[model samples]
Target: LYGLLRRNFRIEEIQLVRPDINLLQKDDGTWNLPITSSDNGAGSSKEAMMLPFIADNVQIIDGNLTWAKVGETTSLSIQNFTIRLKIHSINSFPNMDLNLSVGEMDSTMISPIKDIKANLKTSEGLASLDNLSLNISGGSIEMKGDSTLPSKDKDAEYTATISVKNIDLETLISQFVPEAKELLKGVVDADITIKGQGFDAKADIKFSIPSLLVQDKIKIEQVKGNINYADFDFIISDITMNVFGGNVVGKGTGTLANISNPEFNLAFNVNNIDTGIALTALGQDALLAQGKLSGNINASGNISDIKADGKISSDKLNIKKMGDLTDITAPFRATITKQDKEVNIDNFSAKIYGGSVEGKANIIFGKDGQPHFSTTLNLSGLEAGNALKQLAGKAFLTGKTEGNIQLAGQGTDINTLTGSTDIIFKNGKLATHPIQNLLSVFIPALKTINFVAAKFLSTIGDGKVNITTATLENPQLLMYYGKGQMKLSNQKLAIPSHLLMRCDMVAKMPLVSGAFVREDENWCGIDFNILGTLSNPKSDLGDKLKGQAIGSAIEQIFGGDKDKEDKGGGGIGDLLEGIFK
Candidate 1:
């Protein structure tokens, strides 16, 4: 009798109790239901099953529904659901009114949403959502829309306006990127309008946040922006924020089609930023530098591989590390490129250290997570003595220095450095006490001559600076040519040197004249080594000179030729005997 009734008539009103429904979504996103029946024994006709029917209403009360994709463990479920549909007809182009309320909903894509409610009216292939609201992530969302239901001949289309209020950003972001919750904290509000056909959509959004904290290190205030999204791509405009005691304005475009490696192009302008605060925000010592900074920056590419260009200027900058550079105004520019865990700063120029500096640098991260760096720099008109004193705690030379340095190293330790330098010091004085005493032993006049010039070509490695070639000159009196090495860790020196005295100057120093050999018509020279620290030196000049003097007097006395022997030892023996006595 029930089978006969099902075949002959359509039920007008239907009701369901606390039913649990399970649905499986197919590959094409259509649900598969287990409501098939075997063909009626013999007399059942295809025309009977295809006949049109009518229903006044169908209702579900206190029900649960679970939906999952084929072969997937993650599922979406609605609990405590109540739904009522007033059906006008069940034929082609049917019409209905829908009222639905869901007490709770859970999905793998996000945290649970609750208290969903909606009211809709459908007629003649058009559906109007009078109201829809939900609560998610400590926030509320309200929406209203009109949609064209798809038929065999036409596709679906929709337009909607949604407003979201006071969403907890940390909670929302953690659903997508768990680690970000530790670095970001904020509240968000937005108003959005969306329009679409089928699966394609475009949205216009205006968003604002009152405050945000990053890594508990930087505080940003009053962030607002306008964004347009289409086909997984976004255009952002008129974004403004206050951070690090400065104001920033920016704009950009990006694509989130690949969420893990989104790509972007951005430009920003910053003004009146405090350098100390900025350094502290970046996890550096605030005492490294102090100033006000202004800059313009342009950047492109994904977060992991990006390139940037910028120009920055500072006012009243003071660099504490170099000691004497204070209240300096500086203009700087650079192009920075990053890829594969490496960063390169190219074509960088700066005004610093009472000089102009130009350079390029590279930093690469090793598998051990250590940073290795290389740099090449050209410096002009730098103060040599003051900078040296700041680094080594003593000034060995004083002058205006200019140089080119190429360096490569790992970590921040100076002992790991390997590099080369070509440097010159103009109008300088070698002021170390040991050097002055060593020179005075050979030429008393040198004790008073302070003006000097010097040049050095050196290589540095293994905590030592190897002076491959060096020259120091006091043009009127003497010059020294040397090769040496200094242990940077301890400032120990060992230099083998040759000293040359000018003939005109040597002629005036009678006491030292005969002990030195005249290497050429222009000068006389001696070989000696400058050993020990710069402050205290040891040398063999006195003993060498004494031996040479004795040799010279004996040669004069012996006269090494038959004619000279005959002509004599005229007063030579007496001089020698007096010397021996």
Candidate 2:
């Protein structure tokens, strides 16, 4: 074969393993073969052996390559470790089928593919590839397509379809958009089609991903959607999603007219959203608690510009916990709009802590991209006990209040929303609670761990709360008239010092009494001072009150003046005597 081809054509590298049976034959029956004449005797029963046209790196496993006369409708078949081909005839172009399997090939240019199998057929001037399966990441993909050969005067046309199942979304994204790897993850499935008229191709895509992560910590239990795309325009619709224990429906359309300055519109509807789940889906760090919400929102714009409008309402929203607050509920509603820079609420209202609150606000983005806010609000018929329940960890203060407020400020984040509030409360009461004991700096009996209060009345103003006049009374225990002021700055609170406070702690038994008075408008504590913050306090409540609190209970419990009659008292009297001596 090598000598015959060299006479008419240039030669290159050639190799063969079975040279022992190499042969050549003439048409007239003469032979040039590496075999004994005994094995190739003329008119003998032995037949000529068939040899392969060897090439680089080929392994023949189970089938043979056939050589037949051209234009004779002859057939041939070949199979090897890497390929299998069958041809019915070869005068010009006849029916042929091919299958190829490669262990390592790069299909998407993203990563090396493994276990790839492709099937192709050429028949009657039409060609097609079908059931071409490939391994992608930890998943698999199958594809099929067809095309026509162009005639001398016409162009080619093509169509293709692909299906993906149980594919890793993270793997696909990491290969194409590594920056978003953390923003999305989970299993993906899709059925897609692409068809063309030579120049402008169109695609129809349908896909689903389950338990995907996005926006850092937010999660969607599942999402399914479809897209229609042509040229620079695309539309997606019939999108459904489950997230944070809620259902979401959405639709949108966008143009790639200018990739850098794209444009689009999106609409979303939410129903019966669980607050706890919603918070998690929104990636909120401050909470994962109770509530339910329903709403609709729409937005339109490009990457550099946007606008939106929406409305949300909660007939009843409950939070089991928020810091110290516990088991609370509110009814809320807001109509919101946003045009590029700011979000504005036109009608805002809520029922909170047994209070009716109404307000309007605007949130604007600053030059530095931080949020700034402006708001005005009014609170009516609010119960102090209910309002303070969460913040104080105890709803001990009982009172009704009405107030008006105006606020303006900016915050770096949620925890740092900074502003000042002015509130004026009237006709509030501290009933039966040891709330007065917390003012032990002024109360005389609490020094002995005793709580003795019946009724209290006051008018309070945040940054202006004053006991301008107070009446604490117990027909059977104690009574007092008091006046004082409280100051607020930063986050700290100060209970006024000096004679601005007064107390007469006796009802039927005149056992103890204290007073606070003012001179030159400077009030002084006739007893002791009190100081503390809303969440924490500084002064000892019982420290100074001890000396003035030798009442009947002290006599019955620790034998105060009653000791004058216990001449042989040893438990506490002897110890006190020894200390004095």
Candidate 3:
């Protein structure tokens, strides 16, 4: 009968169960049964021979049977005919009152079961399976009350309440992402419970499938966890996950739709989590830093669309062969939303370096599974020079540099960032090191000016520059454009004595402090324009004694009866070329 039923009904599995019904009789002689299985099978050989069994009147109330196809079962011949079965049940059971239904079923080798229900035994706590109704067309199976044992111990008493209302955890998840159910098959567990209006339940749900072939792409090992969802709250505890040796423990809750929005309060602490191994678990690359990081994150958000606020700090992050000993501590707040074909980040802000970076970003997936996104960052009061050195191991400037930048970008990929920024520098100085070669040769004689003072005011005059763009493209600036002024002071030019003799002029001597010095008091002032590129500037200095020399030379050339005239000091040439003429 077992082999005939396994072949006829297409039952692919079967198991024989031993009875575990212990009945206790009361002393009242009324046979008050604590628990009992009423025997309806053949009582004895003599009684079985006396009564002719009628098949129409006899029906097995609570029963169980396991049926499975053996080896070499081809798809064409592996239909309902290939299933082999063996029956198992409490031989006899007394049902005072009974109501049962098939809750779910596993998928068949060929057809998918959309919905299923089975009769349950609630009398002796043995939970005998009665009948099963399955929808084998779609890949959805739902079994009712005590269909599958909590553990491999078949005789264990089942005491869990079962209530399911519109429950399709896998189906719901598949709607959002068809592969989500497959990805989370072993990565996550969905424990569902429905409790309201004087009803409650608790169930241990497991999605921890070791060696779970995800979409037949990658094989994961030691992925296991348990979830408890009941009474308007859900929690997952004692979660020991595996990814090159790591663990995660937390509790989460929300409405019971796998892909639907669910708010969850989570807390997790990681230990020795190999970033490379962890990222590989999620199908991503791991960029390692200086030291290992260990911290706990407290976040609350929905499953599909979540709002998380947490803080993660590191001792020192190593960016491989670069400078180290850098510490970053930041608090981030962000809201994640999911659309029909994409995910979005709204109001994402984090305090990084010395400034607050705020922005909104999004990732849109096309039909071909390609993701594109755009992000705009508003960074205020950032110390750019210091940040650049920390992130890239090179400084953009050296001396007291500080600024604010407003940047924006859009791209399909996150690696190759494309953006524009408007940066403003105040009292910022590019230290005199990188550009020392270019600037040192210009003022070779002016050795005292070791540092260029780009200030609001100068000792010569008011000095300032409005640098439109200070871009550093390695050894060259893409565009250098600015305007500034270099003022000249009212100081006398100390010319060499050899250059003075070429003038052929003289001036009256002015006696002061017991020393006589040539004085040209009328021609003491000279002015010049200072403007141009940093490499060169416009300037000119005129000789002050030229006027006196011209007058003296003409008189000497036209002399006929020149009187003994003291035109101020001695002869025409002498007077004209005196210290003061």
Top candidate when judged by TM-score against the true structure = 1
Error of 3 at 360 (Å): 9.0
- Candidates in order have lDDT scores of 0.74, 0.55, 0.37
Q: How many backbone clashes does candidate 2 have?
A: 7
Model 3 lDDT tens row, 15-51: 3233222223344322333222344575622211111
Score candidate 3 by TM-score against the native: 0.42
TM-score of 2: 0.57
lDDT of 3 at 392: 40
> For model 2, what is the error of residue 84's alpha carbon versus the real structure, in angstroms, after optimal superposition?
5.5
* Cα TM-score of candidate 1: 0.72
Worst 10 contiguous positions by lDDT, candidate 3: 496-505
In terms of lDDT, model 2 sits at 0.55
Model 1 scores worst on lDDT over the 10 consecutive residues at 331-340
lDDT of 2 at 280: 49
